[model samples]
Target: DAGVTQSPTHLIKTRGQQVTLRCSPISGHKSVSWYQQVLGQGPQFIFQYYEKEERGRGNFPDRFSARQFPNYSSELNVNALLLGDSALYLCASSPLGGTRTGELFFGEGSRLTVL
Candidate 1:
């Protein structure tokens, strides 16, 4: 009955460092997606996973990657971080086939700060 959960609510790293963010989806949900949100801007889709497979990906650079587990939990990893990469990393979950209104349940998000 819980909503999606993300770990390490905040993070700080220097440029060129790598970081990994974690997410656990809602129970019974089969789809998980990642997004990046910068201050004063909307979230940008990064990656989507369904049934443990990559379903869709946005126009992010190759440094961003994600994977879903058998239990529907997922992780997002970013390599060679840049100051421009600092943002709120969000994880969202939805039922398979998507919602009638096409909405997603999102986690509080992991805040990444790159210097």
Candidate 2:
């Protein structure tokens, strides 16, 4: 059972470009998934797509969207990227959601660079 995994560890994109980041949850723990953006301060809650449906969203604009696959994998897609969008995008997996019981496991994250 591997920990959460993310693809394209690093990427470079220009403003207005579209970017897609992928994530896979641990072998058998996928009740919910979370996407977070990390700048300097810390990880900011971006969105939580549960069981293939959007459960919660952050302050991000409509350009930010995501989806969860049947296999428990997920992808975060951002359209019309902005310089401010450059950050470490993190993915977390949990056996249950809305508990906030410190049961979440996170991945190393994909580093996106907007130029």
Candidate 3:
């Protein structure tokens, strides 16, 4: 029973670049969520998906997108990176369909540094 896992634990990029972060949920979990955590702030919800269909999204701009695979793994892609986009991108998996479930298992996160 592994916990959620995310790749490229940390990375650096310049403005205008694009980045993709990957995640794998804990075994048997069907829901995955993406969150952005800025320094001194709690994680902000970005996207949620269940069974490979998008179920929810936050107030982020069109630059942010995500998709969940048939196996329940997910990817978060940020286009035209801005300095404001630099943050710890967290991936959480739950047994239920949404974040309200309070049953989330989170990965350590992929830290992005935009310059």
Per-model TM-score on C-alpha atoms:
0.95, 0.90, 0.96
Better of 1 and 3 by lDDT: 3
Report the lDDT tens digits of candidate 3 across residue range 1-115: 7889999899999999999999999999999999999999999999999999999999999999999988999999999999999899999999897547567889999999999
Task: Specify the highest-lDDT model's number.
Answer: 3
Candidate 1: regions farther than 4 A off? 98-101
Cα lDDT for residue 89, candidate 2: 91
Model 3: lDDT of residue 23: 100
In order of lDDT, best first, we have 3, 1, 2
For model 1, where is the 10-residue window of minimal lDDT? Answer: 94-103
Look at candidate 3 and tell me the lDDT of residue 54.
92
Task: Judge candidate 3 against the unseen true structure and give its global Cα lDDT, from 0 to 1.
Answer: 0.94
TM-score, candidate 3, is 0.96
After superposition of all CA atoms, the RMSD between model 2 and the true structure is: 1.6
Clashes of each: 0, 0, 0
Error of 1 at 31 (Å): 0.2
> How much does each candidate deviate from the true structure in C-alpha RMSD?
1.7, 1.6, 1.1
